[model samples]
Target: MDWDKLRIFHSVAEKGSLTHAGDVLHLSQSAVSRQIRALEESLSVTLFHRHARGLILTEQGELLFDATQQMVKRLEATAARIRDSEDGVFGELRVTTTTGFGTLWLAPRLANLYKNYPSLKIDLMLEERVLDLPMREADVAIRMKEPSQADLIRRRLMNIRMRLYASPEYLAEHGTPSTMDEFGNHRLICQQAGAAQVAAGAELVNQLMTHAVASTLTVNNYFGVLQGVLNHLGIGVLPDYIIEDFPHLQRVMPDLESGEVPVFLAYPEELRHSKRVAAFRDFVTDEIFAFRRSRQTE
Candidate 1:
């Protein structure tokens, strides 16, 4: 199995034409065809189905293509690690976290990081999905719960709890609910019953549902719920940390909240010495420290 042939085969399968693959590989079409033939002969399988429109992979070709895709991802991961080996720290860093936190919290504080390292590039991926840090689905993650993934270095950043909130204007219009039973007079906004969210948040919303309400609004994420609350749509269940930035949000039932959801920052153990990882880790740590200090001062 020659690596060169596999490389050419991968390009040919992707492009669906020998001429196109040849163009990318800087080889003649005939030379690309020769390599494909040699690979198929060695493997004893027809790798493609030729047609008027384009080439389509046979069953075995699909298997080979999948393997090559994984290989490419692994190679990219290796290249990233090698590039990050430099202590200069001026390259791309992929960061992943929940949509609500990424958009509402971390994204705003990232300016300080960029101010420190002007040339640094950040690819922030915000989703509910848990990325595979060790396999390099993302370079690092800030998650509501500690990552259970093995071979990762993790640090507990902080804890958050879900609490009810409403804009002051909305309260001024509809008046405030002074008791749990008084919630029956206002519309309640929250994450949909089965949407992806931390257990504590869902649990708190679920408990709120047990009580009667005047109306109901359900969103899939906290960002939308925040919008609804801010616009005077309804009372929303939101994380406590958001209050630091949105102080105008009046707390409803200040004594009621979800169980503590621990926040953690994690990266692959192999990236322990990566300058990019170190830079991001320190930036986040400094931000959290500042956040904590602000909380105390208030």
Candidate 2:
């Protein structure tokens, strides 16, 4: 199948009108129509049915849409690869990571990456929402949990340990809680939404009520929770990455079990062979593994 014809078909399907597709592609309306017609003939299937206001995909067209999307993406990445075949790494590295990691951890190290590879442009998105790499929403993801998708590649970056900590002033003023039973005596701060597991159509408020411990302050984010603890508002469970060096805060209990949170780096399985992606993945894995090893020594 001609890729140009498939491009026209995909554009028409996306824009829902031949005129709009022509405008987008800088082609005449009749030219767009001819391309669509050629695509349909080559496939021996009716791709779209005419409607009064817009075009609607036929059953066969719906089936082809999935394949067409992947084909177009691979083709674009291939062209970019060809153009960037010189000495240095190039093209946009679309990375998504959580806000705390992006700010405190990755952003600092990214300067070295940019210094080493001046041609590569990085677009980093810091969000709690998970982005699908294979779908091309993001080319790389540093997520808290490992992805379950069979088509994606997952690499364990590190295991983050979380421990309960409180500022010295807060402990002095409110008194320290030495045991699990003493949890009720001290104020607690936690994420508002993740406090409880709620079923669909269940009462959201009720879940919060059941899960939320009484706090001097309620936080909307992980960093906010850390800030609350830093400001001496209350005790909070903080990742070792953020709290490891703080002098004012001390572990809440010597015996309280610390929990491990696994971090993963993910990308599309197909793009493993892409030079830019492979270079990035190997560099990140080495850097993080080195960090983990240094921490172990400390």
Candidate 3:
């Protein structure tokens, strides 16, 4: 019930050592230990199991820790919203997206965002995992599929498809695969069949593999596959959006591509008014528009 004690308990549970938690809280080890003991006495429950290496949370402690973790995330979100109300767009914006979209598309265009709001700090989390926006695991997300969470503001950024491409030199040297049957003559670069990816992408790779490709190079993420393609390793199955940045790459069998994969930008509804979130959302929307315009002219 005591906020101070709960805070200390949360720190100790996170650090797994009273001393480590004390260092973080700027309290003496004895003080932290005393607080923990007092909290356990008040609750009449053992919160941690003490051992040689470190402390492990008991069942009751785990429940309490989960509640406190939620509290921490919510408090941080509130603090960020409050700070946004006071100043220019100047704070950390945690953005989550797939590694392929994050590295290949979003990260490259962020310089302009920095130019406009130089004080903004971007914490870009690049992974396939869909972070919980409502729980504040991340402030914003750009995902390959529509987010189903009900309490979020979602925007369909664009649609993308997996298409085959190869470096000009590679196509020149190895020759282009004019038909699906010719795929066997060149190496096939793609994400691993079972790796986390949009279903359309995997299906595209599966279709290619059915052609009995001569050799293959599989990477866990599209970034690595792009590298393999750029280095002239093979014809790669890549997102169509990426081809704009890599104009020299030649599309193989232009008509062949995976079904559409919708891209969405989403954030917790609470962040609708946060300047940091708004700035990031606008920046991405603008970039997508610019990308679309550039592609139309070409």
Q: Name the candidate that leads on TM-score.
A: 3
Model 1: colliding residue pairs:
none
TM-score of each: 0.92, 0.76, 0.97
* lDDT, residue 20, candidate 1: 94
Q: How well is each residue in 1-298 modelled by candidate 2, as lDDT tens digits?
A: 8878888888998898999999999999999999998888888889999989999999999888878888877776666557546556787888898876777577767766767778788899988777877678887888877787678988898877655678998898988887645666667765565532112202322332354355545555557777889888888755666643464578787564344568898888766666677667777887787777766786
Clashes of each: 0, 0, 0
Candidate 2, residue 42: how far the Cα is off, in Å: 5.3
> How does candidate 1 score on lDDT?
0.92
Q: 254-294, model 3: which lDDT tens digit per residue?
A: 99999999999999998899999889989988999998898
Model 3 segments beyond 4 Å from truth?
A: none
Best by lDDT: 3
Query: Candidate 3: which pairs clash?
Result: none
Clashes of 2: 0
